[model samples]
Target chain A: MATILKVEGLWKNFGGLTAVSDYFLELPEGEIYGLIGPNGAGKTTVFNLISGVLKPSKGRILFQGIDITWFRPDQIAALGLTRTFQNLRLFPSLTVEMNLRIAYHTHARSGFLAALLSTPSFFREEKEIGQKVDRILELFEMSDFREEIASSLPYGWQRKLDIARALVCEPQVLLLDEPSAGMNTKEAEDLAVLIRRIHEEFRLTMMVVEHRMPFVMGLASRIQVLDYGSVIAFGTPEEIRNNQKVIEAYLGVGDLIA
Target chain B: MKQGIRAEWYFLLGGLLLFGGAFLATQFLNRYLLYILVLMGIYSIATVSLNLTNGYAGLFSLGHAAFMAIGAYTSTLLTFPLALREAYELPMLPAFLGGPNFVWPFFPAICMGGVLASVAALLIGAPVLRLRGHYLSVASLGFVVIVTTLAKTMKGLTRGPMGISAIPSYTNIYWTYLWLLITVYVIWRIVNSRFGRAMMALREDETAAQVLGVYPMKYKLMSFVVGAFFAGVAGGLYAHFTKAIRPFEFSFFLTFQIVVMLILGGMGTTAGPIVGAVSLLTLRYALKPLEEHLKIYGLIEIIYAVLLIVVMLFKPEGLVGQKRGVKKITVGGKSSA
Candidate 1:
């Protein structure tokens, strides 16, 4: 399979502290890759770097063979890579439909003049965006909440809306930061199934940074364990589950590594 | 979609009828009332454009008065009569401009002013727009200071702040009303479109919007340039209506007043600034007679302060956008539950 996203020698520093050190990944096309680490193990930091939110102190990243290490976040997203935040980051005051439509910015071709004139082409593009938003809302089962303000939604729905917003952009590589962070076990299991369905439907390469072992383990085809800003093991879910170093890394933290 | 298109046509017809009504009123109304109406129209344009920048884009600019000054001066210089240009000892006109005995028409002069102001906005906004919040505000305020200082010291062009008078009185009620309609229509269209959505998204959360593929710099500069263009046109109208031009006329105080109008009317709503401008201008005119009778110099200013404070306390989101707020949250809450 073709490598869809590749990171090499990725390093992030905050003053004297190293948040991420020599992090690397070679995610193949259409693969669901898992990234698991303890709290502050630089998992989200890696996601940030990959998504162009944070510039790496020293490293390079390639998306579909295009170097994007120095690209701005918006530019990276326009290049067909998108991410969802661990903390929900919806446009709080806007409606759910508006939120999804806004994410279609990359796909829109109409300019200010077209919009000002209300040209037929502009209407066509807007109709296309509306259809996509409707489809995503239906898939997520949030069509009833289309006009609801994003911040006013229940917590779980907001989380679903965040994923929906990212999905609306139709990205080739999706970086999900803790998709099931605050959900119960059953909810996490449901989220895993939903994510798997999404992966199959969209045929997207995903790098999910999740804390819940069962959630990521069940969804991702391969798991990469991280500790202290570096990778400790990389293998299939079963192999990483039994890796001695990964087990020891989670030993003191009492994480479920079995 | 067809229904939406028909409704928009109806809106256009309504706007044209209102313009016709205003035109008739201008013929019969006394000079004082007409002057007040024209002034209100000019302020409406300025406030609406400012709303596009500071309200929708969330770029707190305090330099829009500088843009007005650029427009005022550009239009004034272009439309200045050849006879008066020689008499006032104005600096030589650039060769690219028409020669002696050639005076540019009013429409092109005003449009040229807007274009120049847009250029200036692009130049300054390219770098300064990257800064967010208070930094952007302060930088824009500094732009006002620079423009004012240049107007004061550029003796050859601005006559060293002695000011220019007897400018051609081409700005009648029709001209003012037409420009006001254009500004309102254009801004309304922009705010209802994709560009407007990108702006609101950026305003709510820059990071989220960025990761969603909304280029912040492009939209920020777009709003700034567009807002500056209308402000320039408004300045041109003010110059022609007043038949005078001066550097201090487009000062920080003018910017403050426009900002107040935007905040009081409702920042993001399309009709908010227009309502704010009309109400505020009417209040100023209504209080003028009382102030003269009581011999109180600053009574109007004091009242304005009190009114703004009361509005802020009661309607922090401004007056126009409040109706949806009270009902939507409850609906959202119940539905979510």
Candidate 2:
């Protein structure tokens, strides 16, 4: 498989503390790679570095063989890499339909004059965006909540909406931070299926960060285990299940590792 | 899609009714009432543009009055009759400028005012827009101080403490109303477009917007420039309407008043500033007779302060955008919820 993202010896620091250190990764195209770690193991920090939220003190990142070390977060996203936050980031006062339209603002092909004049092409393009929003809402089972304000939704639905917002951008690569963090078993299972379906349907490469062992273990074809701001082990799900270091990191140095 | 089309029709019909009503009223109203209406028109442009930057795009700026000052000076200098420039002993200017020998027509001069103010906004926003929240506010406030001080010190251009007058009073009912209509249309178009969405996204959350591929710096600066241009245009209108220009006219009080207008009306909605401006201007007129008897200055400002406090206490979202304070709407006894 061709590599879509290559991170070489990335490290990020804040003051005297090192949040993410000596992290290296390769996320291939058309694969769902998982990064599983204990709490404060720098999984999300690694995601932040990859997404350009935090500049790396050392090393570089290349997306599609182009060095993107100095790119802004928006510039990175414009190149078809998009991300979702661990905490929900919906436009609270805006309606769900408006939220989706706003998310697709970057991908819109029309200009200011086109919008101002409401020209024939503008109307055509707007109709297409509306159709796309409708289809995505339907797929996400959020069509009923389209007109409702985003903040008024139940928590579970908001999580789905966050993922839905990211999906609307049609990114080539997606970085989802803890997609199933607050879900129940059934919801998590549903999310697993949904993530798999979206991965295949959108032809996207994904790097999902999660602390839930079962969630990432079940969803990702390959998993990388992180501990103390560095990768401890990386392998398939079967290998990760039996890895001593992974078990020790998760359950501590007890009889379980033995 | 159908709903969007309906909204557009409603906006068009509403605009026609408003403009037509105002036009008819202007023909018959007394001079004082017409003056008050003109003030509202000018302020509507300023307040609405301020709303674009401070409300939708979420950049808190206190320097808009400074941009207005620059516009007032630029427009006044360009359109101030050449004969009067010589009589008033106006300072020498570059040949490209008035140069005490030439003056452009009102339209071109006013446009130049807006363009110059936009350039100033670009220069200021490029550096200061990088700062967020209160830092941005402070930097912009400093910008206002600079403009005000320059107006005081630059005796050649601004005439120092003695105000510049004999400016052609071209701002009749027609021009003010026309410019008001144009400002509303232009701002409304932008606020409803995809670019507007990108701006509001930044307002709500910058990090989220950045992650979504909305460039915060680019959109913030765009909002600032467009907003400043409209403000400058309004300042041109004010200069001609009042037939005078002074450094102290565009002071902190003016900034506070426009900010109050936006906050009282509602920020995101285009109609909010108009309603706010009209209401506040009318309130000032109503209090006009009491000002002489009270023998205190800025009694209207005191009234505005009390009113703003009351509104802020009762309705934090402003007047027009209150959705749930009453819980239900009733025509008579029947409740519509």
Candidate 3:
């Protein structure tokens, strides 16, 4: 399979401190890749760099053969990559459906003039968006909460909604940042299953930045472990689990890896 | 289908109310009352236009008066009656502007005024909009001050402190209300669509919106330019109606009053700003006689300040604030999890 995303020698420096240095990733189309690290390992920073939220100090990122290293966030998304925040970053006051629709903006073809005039083409595109929103909601089993304000949703549901929002843009690549951070084991397990289902359903290339061991191990085919902004190991989940450096990076020497 | 019917009914009701109001203005109401109504309509346009930026897009701009001033000046120059142009001694009127025997019609001139204001907005917004929150507010306020200073010093174009008088009275009850309806309709259409939703998304959380593929600059600049366009239109109407154009009139005080109307009515809702304009304008007119009777010149503003404080304390969302819990969430909606 062709590489959907290629990150080469990525580095991010925040003032005097290096947040990320010489990080590399090559995610194949339709592959599920996991990034796991300790508190300051710069997992979220890598996601930010790929999604164009922050510029890399030194790196190149190619999305589907296009160099998107310097693209703006919206431009990156328009080229079919979307990301979710580690902290819930939903449009709090917007309804669930509207939240999805706003994400659907890049795909929608109507402009300000069409909106102002309410032209037939505008109505057609709006109906299409409504239908797309309905399908996404139903797929997520969030049809019941379609009218609920995003902020008012329960914690688990809000997380689901955030993922759903990213998916609505029909992105070829999805970056999920600490998606299971606040979830209990059972909730995280359910999320893992939902993500697997989404992967199969959409055939997407996904990069998950996670701290949950079982969740990432069960969902991702390959895992990369980071310590102090440098990759310690990159292999299949089983190899990464037993790697001496990764185990030491996560639990220190002589400690159980899992 | 049901929503369509309800909307039609609303249109009918609004039309009836408008007709009756126009009737009263033309027949029953005294000239002073009619004048107040016209002023009310003009202020409503200005307030509604400002709401598109401050209320919906979450850009707290204070330069609306500057855009209006641009519109006012642009339209005034275009429609200044060619005969009067020769009489005014406009030293800086280039051949194209001060050319003999030519006066543009009202509609195009007003539109040109709005276009020019929007152009100005585009020029200013491209850089100024990059700043967020209080910084953006201060930048916009500085823009208003700069425009006022330019109006004061641009003696050839604006006649400096002397200002310009003898402007034709092209605005009336009908013209003012027509523009109000158009403004409301355009903004309402915008707010209910994808463009407006993207704006609200930015307002709620810009970072999230950007990740979702909303280019923040595009939406921000679009809202700012659109808002400035209508504000310019309002300026043109004010210039024509008042039969005078003055730099001092389109200063911070005017912007403050429009901002007050937006807050008092409610931000983010279509009806809020209009209600605010009507309520505040009515109070100002009503208190005019009382202030004169008691010889307390600043009583009107004092009352306004008190009302604003009380509203802020009790209903910070303004009068027409959207109720958070009001949407019908009952698709077997057994409380949120």
Candidate 4:
């Protein structure tokens, strides 16, 4: 598979503090990659950098071999790289269907003139988009609550809706920031299953930043460990479990589970 | 099929009721009452337009009055012949814009004014939409100040604060309400459209909106331009009805008043701005004599301020906000019932 996202020698700073330094990772297409670290390990910061919310102080980010180091968030999104926030940034006032429909805006064919004229073509396109929204909602088992306000949904459902929204963009790569951060174990397990199913179903490249060890281990085909804003370990889940650096970064080497 | 019928029936009934009420008011009310109703109709259009930006798009613009001023001046100049203007010793306007016997039809001139205001909004929105929240609000307020200053300083064009008078009285209760009907219908349709849904999404979460591929700058500019267009139309009608055009007419106070109307009725709701504008305009007209009698020239301002504070304290969502706990009843349920 081709590399969908490549980050090399990425550096970001805040005044005197370097938030992310010399970070590097490449996510190949059709695989689940995990970024695991403790608190303030720059996991979310890495996601923000990839999504173009923050510019890199130094180095390059290439999406499909195109340099997107200085692109705006929307520009990056239009290029089929999308992300969800760790804290659930779903549009609260909009319904679940609306939340997904809004994401399909770039795909929708109706321009301002089409809307102004309310032409037959505009209505046809609108009906098609509506059907697409319905299908996505049904896939997530959220069709029943399509008209309900997104903010009113339960926490677990909100997370699912967030992923559904990202899916509406028809992204090549989906960056999920702690998809199971606030979920119960059952919810977390369910989410892991959903993530794997979606990865396979859509043939998508996914990079998830998560602190939950079991969730990441269960879903990620490859795991990259971060410590102090740098990739400390890169290997399979089993290899990462036994690596001395990974053990030391999470727990002392002597305190490893095995 | 039944759902479509119900929706269409509701719309038709509501429209008919509004038209009947307007017709009755024109037939039975005194001239002063008719004039006040016309003002309310114009203000309803302006307030609804403002809600499209400040309420729906999450942009807090306070420069609506500036767009209104642009419309008022543009239409006034277009319709008022230079021969009459010169005979009255009015300050000379630009050579290209000025000339004896120049007179566009009233309706087309009003539309031209709206287009001119929309163009101004596009120019301003390109830079202004980059800022968010309070930053946007302040930038728009600055725009109003700039426009006011231009009107005050550009003596040759705008007559330097002396204001143009004897504007043709082409706006009547019927025309005002007809335009109001059109404004409300257009906005109602827009608010229910996919574009409106995207705007609401941006208001809910900017980051999420961008990730969803809903370009924030594009939606914000569209809302701003559309809002300014309606405001311009309102301003044109206002100028013709009042039979005068002045820069001070579209002041910060006017913008504040419209904001109050939106807040009072309910932000982000179809009926909110209309209810707010009509109620507040009625209250102002009712209290005018008392204000004059008490020699409290600023009483209106004090009352508005107090009302806004009270609303903020007790009902922050305003009067017509979507009820939080109420479940939306679908067509099936209604039909079964």
Candidate 5:
């Protein structure tokens, strides 16, 4: 598979504290890559840097072989790189449908003047956006909550809506920040199945920043373990499971064989 | 089905009530009451327009009064041939502006004023809308100060601190209500549209808004310009109603009064600004005698400031906030219990 995203020599610092240090990764197109780390391991920070939320102090990020290190968040999003926040950042006042509609704004061609005049083309585009929103909501099984305000949705549904919104952007590479952080075991299992289904259905490349061992091991074809803002291990799940260093990192033992 | 009575219907009904009340007051009340009502109606437009920015879009702009000044001066200069005759000692204004004897009708002049103000807003909003939060507030405040200074300094055009007087008294209760209805309709339609949804989205989370393809700068400028247009219409009516125009009339205090009305009623709600304007104006008129007796220059200001502080402390969401409707769900032949 062709590489969809490439990050090399990435460094981000927050006033003498290195958040992500010399991080390097290559994500193949249409693959689910898992990023695992303990708390404060810079996994989410790496996602932030790649998604253009935080600028890297020193690095090169290429999306589809085009350098996007300096692109703004919106610009990067327009180039089909979208991410969900660790803490849900849904628009509370807007309905679930409206929240998803916002992601289609890039696809909308109507200007303010056109909308004011109620032009036929504007109406057509609006109808198209409505249909697109319906499709995404149905895909996530969130159609019943379409008119409900995002904040009013239950916790699991809120996470589903967030991912649904990100999907509306039609991104090539989706960065999910802890997709099942707050779910129960059953919900986590369901999410794992859903993630695999979504990756296949959308033909998407995904980098999931997660700490849940079961979910990551079950879902990810390849795993990259981050320690102290650096990639300590990169291998398949079986190889990673057998790595002595990986075992020590998780179990805090110097001599452990899996 | 009963929930079909959307918020827009409330706005329309409320506007009708205001119109009916304005008409009734004109028939039974004295000229002073009529004057106050007219002023209230005009200020209501400004307050409502300001709410579109400060309330719905979550932008705080202190320079709205500058747009009012622009409309007032533009209409005054265009219509008041007396100024052309006295200040420039010329018989007429430009031919396109109807010249010396060209007295365009009041409605068109008001519209012209609104258009002019919108144009000015577009110019200023382009650069100012780039600044967010406190920066936007400071930039807009600076704009107001600049416009006020220009009005005072440009003596030949604006008649300086003396102001322009002898404007035609063409605005009456009927015309005021008509304009108010139009303003209310325009604002109501805007807030219910997709653009309004995007604006609220921007207010909630700008980064998410941008990622979703809602350009914050463009929408912010659009709201600013539209809001300025209505504010200009209000200014035009004020100019014609008083048969006089002055720079100080659209001062920082005027901006503050409008802001108070918006906050008091509820910022984002369509009825909030109108409710705020009518309530505060009535209270001010009622307290005028007491204010004179106490020798306080701005008794209303003290009241307004205190009210704002109290409201911010206890009910920062205001009287009418953006509330979500509850939904009932059913699953497996029973309510999801």
Candidate 6:
């Protein structure tokens, strides 16, 4: 399979501390890639670098062979790569539907003048986008609370909305930072199943950062283990489970019970 | 669809009746009432325009008066008589600018004022908008101080401390009333569009806004320019109505008053600023005559402070703010409740 993302020798320095160093990644098209690490192992920083929130100090990032080392975050998103925060980041005061619509900003084809004047094309596109969002909301079982303020939604629903928001822009690559962070074990299992379904339904690549070993192991086709700003091991779930450095980094024998 | 049409018709009819009443007042009412009405109209422009940045985009700028001053001076330098221009030593400008007046008409002068103010905002917004929260406010306040000092020192164009007196009383009910309507309409249209939602996203969380593909700097600069443009126009109207221009008139106090109007009316909504501006100005006007006999300084401003405190204590969101909250959330839904 062709690679959708290629990161070569990526490094980030925050003054004295080196957060991430010499990180390399190659994610194949339509495959799920998992990045696992202990606390403060720089998984989120790597996501930030790829999303263009932080410029890599020394590295090259290629999305489909186009260098995006210094592109702005919005520009990177417009180029069809988007992400969700580890902590939920929804437009708090906006309604759930409006939150989804704003995520669809890049897809809004109506020009500014047209929208201001409420022209025919603007309304037509708006109605079509509305229909599309309605379908997604129903798919995610968020149809019952579309009018609720995003801030007021139940925690699990907010997490679902964050994932839904990441997909509305039709991104080719989706980076999910700790999607199962606050989920109960049952919810995490459901999320693992939902992610499997999503991987089957959508023709896109995914990179997920998760600390929950079982969730990551079951969902990802390939896994990379990071310890203290470096990739310690990379392999299939069974291989990574037995890797010596990965076990030692996680502070115990590899407990693969789940 | 039917509901939208009904609302539009009601808005048109209400506008016509209000305009009719204003026309009658100009022809037959007392000067004091007309003066108060005109003042409210000008402030409506200032507060409503300021809402674009300070409220919707969450910029919290404290230099709105600086933009107003730019508009006032730009319009004044253009239309002040040739004799007045010759009196000031305006060597900094081109020879033609210092020699004869541009002598443009009323509307053109006001437009030029808005244009020049927007230009200044464009130059300043790029650097200043990077700072967030109180840092942004202080930076903007510094801008106001700079503009004020320049006006006091520029002796040539501004006539130094002696400001340009004898400016024509060209701004009447027509000019102010029309500008107020235009300001409200333009802001209303933009705030209801996709661009407005993008702005609110930036206010919610800028990092998330970027991940969602809303560029912060582009929309921030746009709102800043729009707000400054209207502030400049309002300043021009005030200069003509008062028949004088002074550096002290466009001071920190003026910016404070407009900012108060925005917060008291509920910062994010179109109706909040209009409601806030008119009621506050009316209260101040009613108290103006009591100052000399009461012998207390800034009694009117004290009353405003109390009202703001009361709003913060009880209905902290202002009277119209929750309505704005409802505006974005419940669009196109059949359930009204």
TM-score of every candidate: 0.95, 0.94, 0.94, 0.92, 0.85, 0.92
Candidate 3: tens digits of C-alpha lDDT, residues B1-337? 1142356457658867996789777898889989999999999999999999999999999999999999998888888876677689654345675555567788888998999999999999999999999999999999999999999999888988778899888988988888888888788877878788888999999999998888999989989999999999999999999989889998998998999899999999889999999999999998899999999999998998899999988888899987553433223222111
Write candidate 5's Cα lDDT for A31-54 as tens digits: 999999767889989988998878
Task: Report, for every candidate in turn, its global Cα lDDT versus the true structure.
Answer: 0.88, 0.85, 0.88, 0.84, 0.82, 0.85
Q: Which whole-number lDDT from 0 to 100 does residue A55 have in model 2?
A: 85
Lowest-sum lDDT 10-residue window in model 2 chain A: A115-124
Q: At residue B261, what lDDT does model 2 achieve?
A: 89
Against the true structure, candidate 2 reaches a TM-score of: 0.94
In candidate 1, what are the lDDT values of residues B1-337, reduced to their tens digit? 3244665787689778978888788789999999999999999999999999998999999999999999998888888888788788785567788765567799999999999999999999999998999999999999999998998899888876878787899998888888988898888778778899899999989999999999899999999999999999999989999999888988898998999899999998888998999999999999999999999988988888898999989887787865332233322221110
For residues A20-128, could you state the per-residue lDDT of candidate 1 as single tens digits?
9999999999999999977778888999999999999999999999999999999999999999988778888888998998999999999889888888888888888
Chain B alone, TM-score, model 5 = 0.88
- For model 5, what fraction of the real interface contacts is kept? 0.35
Q: Weakest 10 consecutive residues, lDDT, candidate 1 chain A?
A: A249-258
Off by over 4 Å in 4: A253-258, B1-21, B89-100, B292-297, B323-337
Candidate 4 lDDT, A1-258, residue by residue in tens: 788899999998988888889999888988899999877788888998989888889989999999999988888888999998888898877778878878887777676666654566766777777888888888889999888987677767888999999998899999998888777789899889888888888888999988789999988999999888898999999999989888788776674557
**Tens-digit per-residue lDDT, A77-142, candidate 2:** 888888988877878777788788887866788887887776667677777778989998998999
Model 5 chain A lDDT-worst window of ten:
A113-122
Error of 1 at B158 (Å): 1.1
lDDT score for candidate 2 against the true structure: 0.85
* Range of the 10 consecutive residues with the lowest summed lDDT in candidate 2 chain B: B328-337
Q: What RMSD does each model have against the real structure?
A: 3.1, 5.1, 3.7, 5.4, 5.3, 5.0
Off by over 4 Å in 6: A252-258, B1-14, B82-102, B323-337
User: Where in model 1 is the C-alpha error above 4 Å?
Assistant: A253-258, B1-3, B323-337
How good is model 4 by TM-score? 0.92
DockQ of every predicted complex: 0.45, 0.36, 0.42, 0.29, 0.26, 0.33
